[model samples]
Target: MAETKKTSATPTKVAKKEKMLRVTLVKSPIGYCKDQRQTAVALGLNKLNSSNELPDNSAVRGMIFKIKHLVRVEEI
Candidate 1:
């Protein structure tokens, strides 16, 4: 006689979550150039020690890179 193994009929499903970014102004941009300062402002950080939660995308990431020295970033 031969024996066989049984498996479940339903397939496993996996859920995916969208990536997000938390950007905070860690340093003052007063001494920075106009473009850098404007970049920070465009990210919605108008004051020192301010933070904004934004989506993780190329445009936003590019903006962050522009003022990476003036701000802190965390993935959410």
Candidate 2:
């Protein structure tokens, strides 16, 4: 009898799932906290009526919460 060798196959890679949230600046941050202003800046919103799409993560959510009164959020 002859000896035989077995070969293993490579595993397939799966794509990661990403979530998105639409944020819009409705109000001004003139009298808001510094952190709130910073968050707005991070979101790329400097003036009113500006909108941005950000990853729906905990950190972004926290920032939105910090400036909830200064902006509006929608799931997209």
Give the alpha carbon lDDT tens digit for every residue of 1-76 in model 1: 8988888898886876779999999999998799999999999999999999999999999999999999999999
lDDT for model 2: 0.90
Candidate 2 residue-wise lDDT, 1-76, digit = tens? 9998866687666987788999999999889788889999998899899999999999999989989998989998
- Could you give me the TM-score of model 1 versus the true structure? 0.76
Q: Alpha-carbon error at 41 in model 2, in Å? A: 0.5
Among these predictions, the greatest TM-score belongs to 2
**lDDT values for all models:** 0.94, 0.90
What's each prediction's TM-score? 0.76, 0.78
